[model samples]
Target: MRTFIFLCLLFEEFHVRFLVLTTMSTISLATEYRDVRASEILKQIENGEDVNLTDCRIIGELNLSEIEVETVPNPKYSELLESGFFDGEDLKRYGVNKDLKVVESNIKIRNSIFENDLDFSNALFNKSLFFVEGNFTSTVNFLCTTFGDFASFIGATFGDSSYFLNTTFKSISLYGIDFEEMWVRWDSLENSLVFDGLTYVKLVRNFRNLEQFEEADAAYYQYRKLRQAEKSWILFQKEWPWISFPKCGDIFMWLTCGYGVKPFRAFGFGGLIVLSFSFFYRGWPAISLRSEEKIDRICRLLPERLQRFIPTIDWPNPGISRLEPNKHTQKVSFWDAFYFSMVTFATIGYGDWYPKDKFRKWVMIEGFLGWLTLGLFLVTLTNVTIRP
Candidate 1:
C-alpha cells in the first residue's frame, strides 16, 4: 500500500513539472509577439539606429515622411553631372525632381504586424530595407520612395490599400506579396500612380527577372494603355470617333494577343473562334457538302460524339452520303460543320463545301476574322519568340 501511495505522488510530481514547463514555454512564445509602438520604431529610425524586429505587433502610425533628412543628389543624373552636361541647379531649373530625404540605416523587420498606416513617401534608403513576411493591416504608402541599395519584401501581406506610385528600387524583390484582402492593385496603385515610362519599364524588367510573367504582362499592358491614352488625348482631345481610334486598336490588340506579349492568348482566341463558329454552323445547318466524294472523306474522320448524334451513320459513317431531307436545306453531319468552320476561319476555301444563301454573310465575316486572327497570332508569336 505504501509503495502504491509513493508511486502516485511521483506521478503527480511529474505532472506538475510538465505543466510548469508548458506554461513557461507559452509565456516565452507570447513574449515574442509582444506589442511595440510604431512611434518607438520611428524614433529608432530617426536616431539612425538599425532596427531588427521579429514577430511583434506595431501599433499607431509610422509616418517616415516627417523625419527630417538632407536631400541627396539623384544617382540617375550622376553621369550627366560628371560630364558637365547638367548641374544640380540647372537640372532643378529644368523641372527635374530630386529626392526629399534619405534614410541611411539598416532595417530588417521580419514576420511583424503593422496595425496602422505607414508612409515612406519621397524618402530614399541607402541601406538594406527588408520587411520579410511582414503584415500591414492598414493603408501603406511609398509614393516616390527609392531604395538605392538592396530591398526585399518577400512573403509580405497587406490587408488594406498599398501604394507604390512612382516608387523606385534597385536590386529589389517583390515576388511574393499577398493581397488576400483585395487591396493591392498593381496597375495604378488605386489611381494614385502617375505614368512614368522608365518606372514602368523597370517594373516590367523586375517582374520578369523574378519569373513573374503575368505581373510583367500587367505592367507592360498598363504602361502601353496609359501611353496610348496620353497620345490620343494629346492628338485629338474632345474628338468623337477620331479620339477613340487608338483605343479601338488597343482593345483589339488586347483581345487578340494581349498586346503582343502573350502568344498563347492568340492561339487560345483562335481556337475559341473556330469552336464557337463550328457550333453556329451545326445549329444553323449553314454548310452543305459539294459532292458524294467529300461526304465519304469526312465521315471516316467524324468525331465520335458527332457520330452518335447522327443517325443511319455507321460508327464511322462508312460509304454514306445523303441528299437534303428538305430541298431548301442540307442535313450535313457535325463533321461537315466543323470542317467548314475550320476552313472558313482559316480563309482556306477548298471549294469542296459552300455556304448556303443565308450563310454567305456569316461565312464572309468568319473568313475575314480568320484572316485577322491568324495574322495577329503569327505576329504575336514572332514578337514573343524573336525578342531583341
Candidate 2:
C-alpha cells in the first residue's frame, strides 16, 4: 500500500513537470543582438567597441572557452599611450619600459540564457562581470579564471554541474543562485579565501523559505564542515601545547561523534568501551557483597524494638538472602561480567553485586568514564535530532 502511494506521488510530480515545460513560451535572441558571431564580436572589440547583451538569450551553443577576452585595451590607457606624438623609442628612453599588457574590456550579458554548455575556463576579466537573471542549460566552467574586479551571479540558474576550481575573484556576489552541483577546491585558496556569513545564510534562508528543508540542511551541513575545517586548521597550527591540545580534542570529537553530524558513531564508540570494561571485570571479578558473618556489628547497632522487627537483619540466614556472594567460581563468566559492567556503568548499585575492596579504584575510574560517555551520547543525539 505504501509503495502504491509513493508511485502515485512520483507520477503526479512528473505530470506537473511535463505540463509546466510544455506550457512555457520559447524566447528568441536574434531580435535583440545585431550579430551573434564570435569573430564579429572580437573584431568589434579590437576596433574599440563595447559589446553589451544586457537581456539576450542564445538559442544555440556559445563556445567562449579558452578565449582571451582581455586583449582589448582600456580606452583611457589607449588615449594616453598611443598618441601620434609619442613613439616607442621616446617611451623606452624614460623609465616606462614595462610591456603594454592588454586591459580587459567589459562584457555585460545580464538576463540571458545559454541553451548549451558555457565554458569560460582560463579567462581573465578586468572589469565587473554581471550574470543577473542568467540561466545555463548545461555545464558551466570557470576553472582557473581570474576576475580583477567585482563579479555578480545573482538570481542565476545553473542546470547542470558547475566548476569553479582555482577561480579567483576580487569580490563576488552569489545571492539567490540556483546551485545545482558546484565543484570547488576551496582549500587550495585557503589563505586568500574569505567567506562572510551573509551569502550562505541567504542561501539557507532561501531554501528553507521555499519549504525545501532537506536542501537547506544540506547547504547548512556543507557550511558547517567548511567552518570546522577552517577553524581546525588554524588551531592546529599553534605551537603551544595548551593551545593545541584543545584543537586536538576538537578533532577527536569530530572523528568519534562527527561534531553532532553523526550520532551512531558515538553510540558505537560507547558500546565498544563498555565491552572492553566487561572483559576487565571478567578477569578481576571486582564485585562481591558482604557475607552474613560480617553483619553482626550492624545487628548490634540496631535498636532493640527494630532488631526484633527486622529478624533477618539481626540474625541473617545465608541460605535465605539473595544479597550474599555467589558460591560459584571466583572469576565471573563472560555473561556475568557483561551484566555487571552494564549495571556499574548505569550506576545502579545492586546489593547482590558490589565491587571488591581490592578493585574499588578501577570501578571508580570506570564509573567516571561511563558518566562522560553517556553524557556525550545524549548531547550529540539531541544536537543531530533537533538542529537539522
Candidate 3:
C-alpha cells in the first residue's frame, strides 16, 4: 500500500511542475505594454534617445499625434564652445559665432505589433524613423508629419485604413508597403503624390515587386501630369507682373497641350486649324491659277535656283485641241483646297498650287502650326511608347 501511495505522490508533483511551467510561458508570450502612455514615448524622443519597440504587442493605441520636436545643440559643438575653440577672430572667419545647434529624433520599431490605432499625425521627426516589418491592426495616421532626414517603412502591414495626407519625407525608403487593406487617403494626396528623381524610381520598383502594375502605371501618369502643371505654374508665377502675353500663352498651352501632358490633344486642334485655313483659301482668289502656257513661259525666264522653287507643269497633249479649262487655271474646289492646305501645313510645297498675294501670310502661319503640332505629336508618341 505504501509503494502505491509513493507512486501517486510522484505523479501529482510532476503534474504541478508542468502546470507551473506552462503558465509562465503563456504570460511571457502575452502583450507587454498594456498600460504604456504616450508621455513616456515623447519623453524618450525629446531627450534625444532612440525609441525601439521591436516585437512588442501594445494593448492600447500608440498615439504621438502633434508632438513638437525640440532642437538641441550638438554635444560635440557644445564642448568645443565651452573649451573656447572659436575665439573672437576665429569665430568671424568660420561664420559661426555660437554653439551649433542640431536636431535629432530617431525611432526604430521594427517587427512590432500594434493592436489598436497608431497615430503620428503632425508629429515632426527630425531624424530617422524606422518601422520595418511593423504590423498595425487598426487605423494609422501620418497626416502632415514631416520626416526631415530618413524614414523607412519596409515590409510594413496595415490592417485597417491609414492616412498619410500632406505627409512629407526627405529621404524616404519605401519597399513592400502593403496597401491591400490599408485605405490610404489618396484622393486628398493626389497632387502631393508627385514623386520625382530617386523616389519615383523606387516607388515604381516597389509596386512592380509587389506585382501591382496598374498602381504603378497610375502613379507614373500622375507624376507626369503634376510635373507639367508645376512647370506651367512656375512660368505663370514668373510672368505674373506683365501678364498679358504670358497669360495668353498659358491659356493656349492649357487648352491645346494639356499643359504638356496630352500631345494627342494638339493633333485634334491642328486638324481644326487645317480645315479653317482650307475654307478661307477656297473663298477669295488667294491662289494663282495660271495656264500651262503661262507657267512654261515663266519657267523659261527663271534661273536654275528660282526654277527649283517653282514646280514643273507637264500638260497632257490630247492630239486634238479641246476648249476645256486649263489644268493650272482650274477653279479650286473644296477638296482641292483642303489638299493644298494639307501639303502646305506639311511643308511639302509641291508647287502645283502657289499661294498668291495676301494668301502668302496665311500659308506661313499654317506652316508654323503644322511644325508645332508635328513636333508635339512626335514627342507625345515617343513618351507614350516608352512609358512604363
Candidate 4:
C-alpha cells in the first residue's frame, strides 16, 4: 500500500510539470502572435494604408526604428489624435526620430477633440508637411525641425504658444492660425521668404514676409506704434518750422511774405527780370514836368568822381531812366526785388538787365541767401507730402 501511494504521488508530480510546460508554450506562442500583428500593422502604415486606431482600448508605449507613416487619403489628424490610442510616450519613443520618414501626409484636425499634449520637436520631415484646416486644443511644439519641402499650416488654431524656433522650411504658409495672445518664433538662417497678410505680431515685427516664418500678435502692436510715432514726428517738423529754428520764425516769415518768395519762386524765373529792373531803375515817373526832371538835375549836380564811382546813377535823365543818382530815392517793390535778387544770386543772366559794378556784386550775395531759403522750403514740403 505504501509503494502504491509513492507511485501515485510521483505520477501527480509528473502531470503537474507537464501542465506547467504546456502553459508556458501557450504563453510564448501568444506573445509571438502579438509581435507579428504589431509588425504587420507597421508594414501597413509604411505602405500608405489608412489606419483607424479609434476603437483600440489598450495602447502600450511603442518604440520603433526607421519607420515611415504616410497618410493615404488625407485622414483627419485630430481624429487620429482623439482615437485614444496614441499616447504621448509612445510618440516620443516611436514617432519622434530623425531616421523616421513621413511623406505626403495631409494631417487635418477639423474641430476634433484632443486630450493630450502633442510634441513634434526635432523631428525631420522629408516630404510635404500639411496641417491644413486643423484645430489643436493643446500646445503644439515643432521646434528645430528641418522641412525638406513645402510646410503648410493653413487654417489651423492653437490654444497656446506655437513654438517653431530655429525651424527651417523651403516654403511655408500659415494663412489662418488663431493663437489668441500667444508668441510665435520662426527664426531662420536663409532668405527669399514671403508672408502675405499674416496677422501675427511677432511675425510682423521680426520678419518681412510670411512664406518663411509663422505669425503672432504682440509684435504687430509694437511695430504699428513705432511707425505711427515716426510719421507724427515728420509731420510736426514740416508744419512747425519754429520747432527747428525757434528764434528764426520772423526771418522765415519775412522771406515768405515780405520778400514775395512764394510767388517769385512759382513764376519760373520771369520774376528775376522784375527784380533787376527795380534795383537799377528805382522808381516810376511822376505827373509834374519840373518834378520829373528834378531827379536828373540833382544827379548832374553830383561831383564827376562820385558819378564815376556809382555807375547806376544816370545824371542825364535820372527821372526817366531806371538808374538814379541817389540810393535813397530809388524805391523798389517787393516782387521786383525778389526776382532781381534770385537771378543775381543764381548767376543766370537774362541779358535784358544789368547790375552797376560793386552794387551788383553785393546784390549777388543776397541772391545766394534767397536760393538757400527756397531750397529748405521745398525739402520741408517734400517731407510733409511724401513721408518715408
Candidate 3: which pairs clash? none
lDDT per residue, candidate 4, 320-354, as tens digits? 22333454344333333333445555556454344
- Check candidate 2 and list the clashing pairs: none
Residue 36 error for model 4, in Å?
24
Candidate 2 lDDT, tens digit per residue, 1-388?
9999999999999999988776663333233533254455455445445667765655554444323333432232334367776655664453232222233666667777777677665456667777777887888877656678877787788888877755666777776777666665434333333345565665566556555555565566566666666664333435642345555666656655665556567667667766887667655546653444433343356467744552232222121121435554243334445555676676765554567777788778777767766677788678656754
Clashes of 4: 15
lDDT of 3: 0.61
lDDT of 3 by residue, 255-315 (tens): 5665555667887787888788877776666665434454445445646685466344332
The estimated TM-scores of all candidates read 0.44, 0.39, 0.40, 0.31
The RMSD of every model to the true structure, in order and in angstroms, is: 18.6, 20.6, 19.1, 26.0
**Candidate that beats the other on lDDT, 1 or 4, i.e. the better one:** 1
Instruction: Answer with 3 or 4, whichever has the higher lDDT.
Output: 3
| Local distance difference test, each candidate | 0.71, 0.59, 0.61, 0.45
Better of 1 and 2 by TM-score: 1
Clashes of each: 0, 0, 0, 15
Model 3 regions lying over 4 Å from their true place: 1-40, 65-103, 180-324, 327-388
Which has the better TM-score: candidate 2, or candidate 4? 2
Instruction: Rank the candidate models, highest lDDT first.
Output: 1, 3, 2, 4
